[model samples]
Target: MLMKATVSGSDVKTGGIALHNLQKRYGNAIAVDDVSLSISPGEFISLLGPSGSGKTTSLMMIAGFETPDSGQILLDGKDITRLPPHRRELGVIFQNYALFPHMTVAENVAYPLRMRRMAKVEVEKRVGHILDQVHLGALASRYPHQMSGGQQQRVAIARALVFDPPVLLLDEPLGALDKKLREHLRNEIKTLHKEVGKTMIYVTHDQDEALSMSDRVAVMHEGRIRQVSAPKDIYRRPADLFVAGFVGEVNLVPVKLKSGTVHGPASENLPAPEWQEADRDATLCVRPEHLHLKTSPPGSSGGLQGRISGMTFVGDATIFQFRSETGLELLSKVLNVLPETMPGVGDPCVASWAANDATILTE
Candidate 1:
């Protein structure tokens, strides 16, 4: 019987990574601006953004693939900004997997150790250890072409870890797989991180992946980091307009701030934002799930009159869009469990939420 390979929490090498005011430019375009980040030892951080948003460029610079125009990158307290890619001692996994086609899984995993000229016996020992660790011991002799995508991916990751590099950088490692496989691999990667305890930097445009796996997510846009925070905080308490709008679904309603409240576009009074100054134009940001929709306006302050416009059946829940009597559109998410209680489109309803659920973006 084959068993999954094991690694003790103490078995993996660990390192801290820091990027100090990193800047990179290509011709007149700035790929990464003066971005400084301090990542803790063994923490998993994701550089997340859309295309041309500088996340990938920052990762490449950390890996020594792209030279920065200015600033520095430190690994375990040493500057490696100018070091060549191979000399930086970093393990990298690309979207393509990058496994040599003709090589057996064992050969592919062992190639890094062999390159260092380790004794053949030691190389064999290390290869066997990692093959078991990744649960690929039985398929050691099989070539890349003979394995499923997930298996090939496992082989690629095993190759990266076999050499015991202190830092692991993954660029869209799960971009190619189907949803089910991607979800499985994500759990595997998270488990691997716990066992190995090495600093891991992952780059991806997938919000779900970043939010689900990372210890912290650095949201990047327009060559700058918009916000860096834990997954829940990034979604619930974004720092600015861009970050609030980018990370997830939020209903943006224009409002003008007063001494103690936000006057909505529909001339309704909503809760005052804790952070806004008096008399400023702002947008009231509230996520759909935070809004409660009812058939009639609530007995008191929580309710805001609205008419249901449309709804969408998102796999886990239904999202309903409502137009307030003042002509402002807002959204509410209702779970699918209650068929009788669920409101239909065009139904007259009231949208209500707690004052704390809203963030007023004055900028």
Candidate 2:
């Protein structure tokens, strides 16, 4: 259970951030290019991309650790582009838990308050309250060396919260933990966000973290944001080819659009993009899960006829690789229940999906 901490006044309604044309460059190389985004108060937004996509660099600029070459950083409509990190009054958590080795959990959590010259009694009270809130009350006396990675991360979170800042910036806070622990901590962090209601700007390269935890995800690529949308929209209705291909495992099929129809390998007269021009080339994006597989006659008419070229059982789901009669490869994912019903390798199958399940990408 996490406790809510006040910032300024009870009715302040703080934690809105806006980045306007923020750009950063390293000599001739552009790290961030014309990036702009507005986050609502108490919204949990994730900057998601592969490494060097400028997610971390954008976070650093917001934290005041890195100055932008051009543009502005505004918190609640006030420009803080040139403010120092400590003066920005923002809570920041790094991938590495940057706790002092010699400090105990309680002392570490109290460091922010101490640095502010808070009275000793108030610091001790806040430390005790936050430790208990993070379920670290019993480990208050444990030094960093005596704690596990997960516990150390909790200490970092508690420290960040102890000061009760309006906004929290997390840069891959769980990147150092093992998979199981990372998943567990992800839930805890989500719960913390709800309990505290602080605006959270999370930077992560992990799609699962962004998809599962964020209210909206800003997908970045090549130092620019490709798309900003809710997780479902980001996955289902990606804005472009880059966003479709980056967010998930997708099968991109080259096709031609003519007279309100789509023509592709082993497929014709399929759905066409409502806004796309006719008689042009486009790509079809479909996720493996959307493609359904069923044993069918060699010459199926309703769907593409294919042979199961390969099959892989991945715990909860099985992945089936299908080779269409036209030699186009497609993948289908099916739940593992009733394994006897699944098609075997080399079996004739029909792969199909609803028209709406596929997206047409012009680029």
Candidate 3:
């Protein structure tokens, strides 16, 4: 049987979250600076950025945990900027499990229902349902201390969903788990979000996590929403220098734009009619995956030559560090399979990519 996909707050909901010129400040530092964005209904959106970028602060404002210094926050057509935390009807999952060590899994999941004065029978029914949803029904009687980290996370998710809130807010929910466990639970959390069908707003600094899980990603920087788009668009076509560098591994080569083509320090040229006619200063941005490495001498089409500075095996792909004669430090990825003739460290090699492979950025 085909598996049914889980639902996030996006399922039952038909509207989205809108921030209109939202701003928050503390003395001289601006936490969120006139930021605005529209989150589609049911869209899995992530606030992705490094620490102190105001992503968490913006989320707190939406949850009514922090008051915005200016602007409006709207859910659907209603203004919810001033609503209290309890009145906002949002399910919040934090980095910490925040479960009571003394309470059994069932009790922890049932806590939310009890807070609303739900009857004993109704609470049990809801708790049972959520435990089954999180695949912890058999371990319902076990306490937090008795379960693994992943299981504890499931209990937290269960508690968040048991009340059936309108929105689910996850604040780096997988931050504390080990690498393998984090990867496993990432899919699980995504699965639970879909099953619950609640509109969700996830926050994290991990780029891979955001890319793999979110339907759309909001790249935040210096108290602003720098770019908001689908995961592919965010990675393939970044809006600025920050987005390009922050989203993935890439090498940037300074170049000059003349008559619609980009001229790098080396002989390789880029196709850009607009850039050729544009300003003199430009940059060529290329991802690691697009680079081609060769140990032989160049043919009619000569590529940039460089010395292999280092090589590291990362299982699936090997990372090569190259220093071009023109002073460009570049990193390229090669497949792990043999007969591809991987470049050894300190070997002189040629690096080349298609003309269309490089992105021209004026900044």
Where model 1 places Cα greater than 4 Å from the true spot, the runs are 1-14, 272-276, 297-302
Candidate 1: C-alpha lDDT = 0.85
The superposed Cα distance between candidate 3 and the true structure at residue 278, in angstroms, equals 2.5
TM-score of 1: 0.93
Q: Kindly give the stretch of ten consecutive residues in candidate 1 with the minimal lDDT sum.
A: 1-10
Winner by lDDT between candidate 2 and candidate 1:
2
Question: What does candidate 3 score on TM?
Answer: 0.91
Tens-digit per-residue lDDT, 100-181, candidate 1 = 9989999999999989999999999999998898899999999999999999999989999999999999999999999999
**Candidate 2: tens digits of C-alpha lDDT, residues 86-189:** 99999999999799998889989999999999999999999999898889999999999998998999999999999999899999999988999999999999
Question: TM-score for every candidate vs. truth?
Answer: 0.93, 0.94, 0.91
Q: What TM-score quantifies how close candidate 2 is to the native fold? A: 0.94
Q: Which is the better candidate, 1 or 3, if ranked by lDDT? A: 1
Best by TM-score: 2
- lDDT per residue as tens, model 3, 1-363: 011112232223354677778899999999998787777677789999999988999999998999998988777657889999988778888899799998999999988888899999999999999899999999999999988999999999889889987678899999998999999999987887777776789999999999999998988888988888889888877777888899999888888886666776864664433453544787777889888777754343457777799888899988889888787899998776473577678777788877667777676
Give the RMSD in angstroms, all C-alphas superposed, for model 3.
5.5
